[model samples]
Target: MSKAYVFTRNGGPEVEALVDRDMPTPGPGELLVAVRAAGVNPVDWKLRKGYTRPGSVPQPFPTVFGSEAAGVVEAIGPGVGGFAIGDEVFGNPVAGGYAEHTLLPVAVTAHKPAGISFADAAVLPVAAATAYDGVRQLGLAPGATLLVTGAGGGVGSAAVQLAQHAGVRVIGVASASKKAFVESLGAVHVEPGGGLADRVRALAPGGIDAVFDLAGGDTLREAALLLADPAALISAGDKQLVAELGGAPVERARTAAVLVAVAGLVVAGALRTHVTGTYPLSAAGEALRAVEDGHALGKTVIEVTV
Candidate 1:
């Protein structure tokens, strides 16, 4: 038997709870993983709270909550290749990751880097991939100035580092407490408030070359207003806003591609994972609460070692 975090109904965090179930066997073209760590994201709670769009739900009842995880390949399904039992791997599986065992497609899984730990490897899928996609969408050139809203969050922090890696100047928007951290990532921090655009303009008078809005509210609107001509804008948070700015929706295929690129970066030592806190599988509720309260500095992960 394997323990998994499953949501039986659509409601708040209270409605979604962890339960023990029989271990699942991988199907054709799939790989069964013994999950070592599971990265928690806002989406998990959003889905539990019924904030997710109807189309995003693949199953009705007893749905799994997580998508990203790192583990050792315990078994490979028929016809699967390029992997073996005991191979260390990390990827976003189709089912819930907040469990001791999970199944994922072979295409989405990748070999873990030798230098990275399981905790670090688990943080790369969603956050790092989203940042990569946003940066790629902008086609940002070297020396170009890029504005990243919500610059202290997971995707935001990742964007700050990835932008700097690409030789782009970054202006990060974050709260007062996160100012130093954002700056450490090589971005000029702007406090979030009414005068945010003014502050950004003060930093770069001619305006920015691209805008990556990870926080979607007034900051996103401000980003749209400040975009340079023929500018690139990408948002991983708001689909409606993305459409309004003529940007495409972030789909599974695109997400997978971005993750693959991020994995390559981890292998090359150009990127690093940042995990703020970790919780045992039994404390999944507390972990979700921490994420909802916005207390974590980086990715909050659940360690399912049992």
Candidate 2:
């Protein structure tokens, strides 16, 4: 039996429990992985509260609570190609990642690079990949100034670093507590809340070339005013608000090729995963709480002991 941290029903943390179940068998084009690490994100707890991604199939009771993981391949399903038993890999999971084992679709999975740790690789599939997609979608050139909201969280931090690496000047908006942390990613730090647009204008008088928003609602609305062309505004946080402001949601290329590219960037030292905390599988709830609390500095990952 494989042990998994799961939510028995849609609710709050009270619905969560650790239980044992039979290991899953991979379907065609899937791989059964012995999970070594799982990345925690805000979406995990949100899902427990019954949040569903657009077009996602409804999951049943006792659902696992993670989106990405890294581990060794234990069994390969029929019709899968280019992967072998015992090969290290990481990607978005089939059901959930907070378990001793899970299934990974070959289409979104990628081989783990030797230079990247399982904990770091575990996070790339979600946060880093989203950053890549958002940055590329904005298509800002070097010397261009970009503003990133919620710059202290996983996706925001990665987005700041990626923009800086591309030679784009970045102004990062986060809490006052994260000032140093945001500036460490090569961005000028501006605390969020009241007069946000005025503070950002203080940093870039010529106006921001683009806005990469990870904080939605009021924060997004404030940043939207900074852009001359609303087409330069893109968001991963509030899609509906973005559209209402005449901006588009960040276009995601959820492909293994994209995963491979992000991993290569990590290996090449152009991007840092910056995983700030790790918890054992037994402490998965604590890990989720760290992210769900909205105070986590970088990325939080659950390291599963074999």
Q: How far is each candidate from the true structure, as Cα RMSD in Å? A: 2.0, 0.7
For model 2 the TM-score comes to 0.99
Over 1-306, each residue of candidate 1 has an lDDT whose tens digit, in order, gives: 888888899887667778888888999988999999988888888877777664565666787778789999999999998899999888888788888999978777778877778888888887887787777777778999998888888888888888889999999988888888788777998987887777888999978887788778777877777775523777777768766876544443434455667877877766766688899999988887887776566678898774
Give the alpha carbon lDDT tens digit for every residue of 142-224 in model 2.
Answer: 99999999999999999998999899999999998899899888889998887999999998998899999999999999999
Cα misplacement distance, residue 269 of candidate 2 (Å): 0.7
Candidate 1 TM-score versus the reference: 0.93
lDDT winner among the candidates?
Answer: 2
Off by over 4 Å in 1: 53-57, 246-260
Instruction: Kindly give the number of clashing pairs for every candidate.
Output: 0, 0
List candidate 2 stretches off by more than 4 Å: none
lDDT of each: 0.80, 0.94
